[model samples]
Target: MNVYAKNILRFVVIVFLQVLILNRITLHWFPEPAGALFIPAIYPLFILLLPFETPVWVLLLSGFTLGVTIDSFMTTAGMHACATIFMAYLRTNVLNALMPRNLSEYINQQPSIKTMGWMPFLVYSGFLLLIHHLVFFSVESWSAASIGSLLLKIAASFVTSMAFILVYILLFTRQNVARA
Candidate 1:
């Protein structure tokens, strides 16, 4: 399949999964008054997995579109857009740092555990997801007074989101289990 077709499919599928299923799941380990409130989000994986050659403008646009889509569904009032766009803005720097060489060196490759190796791919995705969650939770709370609550929300949401992301890779990828 073509990259555009595949990405479009990813966009639809991830958005559906997020809006229909993941959004309905509200996780809390403690009482509402004590701990953080969040849901596990895997939608950010769409932005993370785009082809290496994708331009920054496309990333920004895609991120905005995706975030706006989710916000429209959740009625979060552009909170998701703000977080996703920030993450999109940082994607290039994160990829460049985690990548061994310039993105040009990899013609047809997109990021995955297969291409970037386990550690680098994890760091790349993890860092970005953390940024996304941090911005999202911080914006949701919109306060610096409760640093503990903000950190708890970020960490909890990040871990939850990453778990769902791993399941997504395990279920969806073609060579995820096969050795090259």
Candidate 2:
């Protein structure tokens, strides 16, 4: 399938999975005071999978759209949108730092474990997930929750989200698909 068609499919699938399935999950390891640890989010996987050559404007718009879609369902105000846009804004810089010196080679490709290799792709995904979670949890806990709570939320959410994203890529993404 073409990149556009493939990304469209990914967009729908990731959103649905996130809203219908993942959003309902609330992991808790601590007692009453510390209640739910975090919510595992996989929606950002869509933003991360956009074509490497996608422009910054498109990235920001798409990220906002995706986040808003999730927000409408998840009822988190604009938290998701804000976090997603922040991550989208930093995507190019993160990619450039993680990628090899030869830019032309990866221009038309998607950032994936296959194309970028395991280590670089892992680092790229980790960085984005951390940033995304930091923004998300930080905003959610802004005034109401304590700094410790915010840090715990960020840590838990990041690990859970990263786990889901890695598994999704390993199991579903066409790792061996032709690269640019």
Candidate 3:
């Protein structure tokens, strides 16, 4: 199977999950107001899974398209698009910083638990997720608001999104653990 075809399929599946499943999860499920304070974001997993050698222009375009698609469904204006584009832009820098200096064999491969090892993959995902959340909430809160509440929302959502992302990576990203 072609890699791009598989990635497109993943893109569809993730968008569907976000729009149909995760988006409907109410805040009332958690403690009284905590639920209202947090909304897990897992859609960024698609962008995070892109090939390591994908070009900057491609990344930005893909991110924008994905974000716009989600925003259309959620009717959240263009906040998703903005955050997603920013996340995509930062992905390369994060990859360079975390990956080993030797890049001979790693080019064009997806960063997965199996491919990059657990720690590197975790750190990479964490850093990107943080940037995504920060940009997302900052855009969402770009209005008259309370600083404490905004921070609380960002913090709560960031934690939930991270936990959800890690679980998703563990379950979905092909892990090629080797036995000694």
Candidate 4:
């Protein structure tokens, strides 16, 4: 019920969905010869939902731990770790730019459509997800050999991840809509 306990539970649930469920499904938008596909990752939503007051050190540490956990399960070496950490690093800046007030004003609140409204929240999460996907795909291929293919993979994965994250917000974050 408390924030810490809630976050801990969220961490477990997101990772469970990512590792056991989403990881099992792969999306292929391109033909077989191109071999461009995507595996949507909703785990970044954990970091996105963390409280505004969480320290940078804590963010980095959490990102590393979360990424390492996924890496261990999915066995992609350290690709997830690398991408998550990078997303964590840029999270604050993205929030600052999108938010009208200082993050300190939002100490008691987590970023969500209810708190920040849909556009800002989506932009914040979308930008970080983009960073995560870019870093992840880049590290996976470890080369720019197929620039088109890489971009396609990133785009496909980003879109899928965003859709999943939106569904998650709608289902779990809760909304209080009042008709005026």
Backbone collisions counted per model: 0, 0, 0, 0
* Model 2, C-alpha of 61: deviation from truth (Å): 0.4
lDDT by residue (tens digit), candidate 2, 1-180: 888888899999999888888877878656645545567899988989898888889999999999999999988989999999999999988988888664446666888877888899888889998999988887887785477766776787788789899889988965445555
Model 4: per-residue Cα lDDT over 1-180, one tens digit each = 799999999999999999999999988877874656568899999999999978899999999999999999989988999999999999989988998888888877999888888788888999999999999999999988898888878888888899999998889965556633
In Å, residue 156's CA in model 1 sits off its true spot by 0.9
Off by over 4 Å in 2: 35-37, 102-104, 175-180
**Model 4, residue 164: displacement in angstroms?**
1.0
Q: Point out where model 1 deviates above 4 Å.
A: 176-180
lDDT of 4: 0.90
- Cα displacement (angstroms), candidate 3, residue 95, comes to 0.3
Evaluated with lDDT, which candidate comes out highest?
A: 1
TM-score of each: 0.95, 0.91, 0.89, 0.95
Sorting all predicted structures by lDDT, with the top scorer first, yields 1, 4, 2, 3
Q: What is the lDDT for 117 in model 3?
A: 83
Local accuracy by lDDT, each model: 0.90, 0.85, 0.83, 0.90
Q: Is candidate 2 or 4 superior in lDDT?
A: 4
Candidate 3 lDDT, 1-180, residue by residue in tens: 698999999999989988898888744334655345455789999999998888889999999999999999989989999999999999988888888764445766788877788889888888888888888888887864566666667777877888878877768855446753
Write out the backbone clash pairs for model 1. Answer: none
- Model 1, position 167, has a per-residue lDDT of 94
Clashing pairs in 3: none
Candidate 3, position 91, lDDT: 90
How well does model 2 score by local distance difference test? 0.85
TM-score-sorted candidate list, best first: 4, 1, 2, 3
lDDT of 1 by residue, 1-180 (tens): 898999999999999999999999999866776575678999999999998878999999999999999999999989999999999999999999888789978998899988988899899999999999989988988989989877877887788899999999878878634555
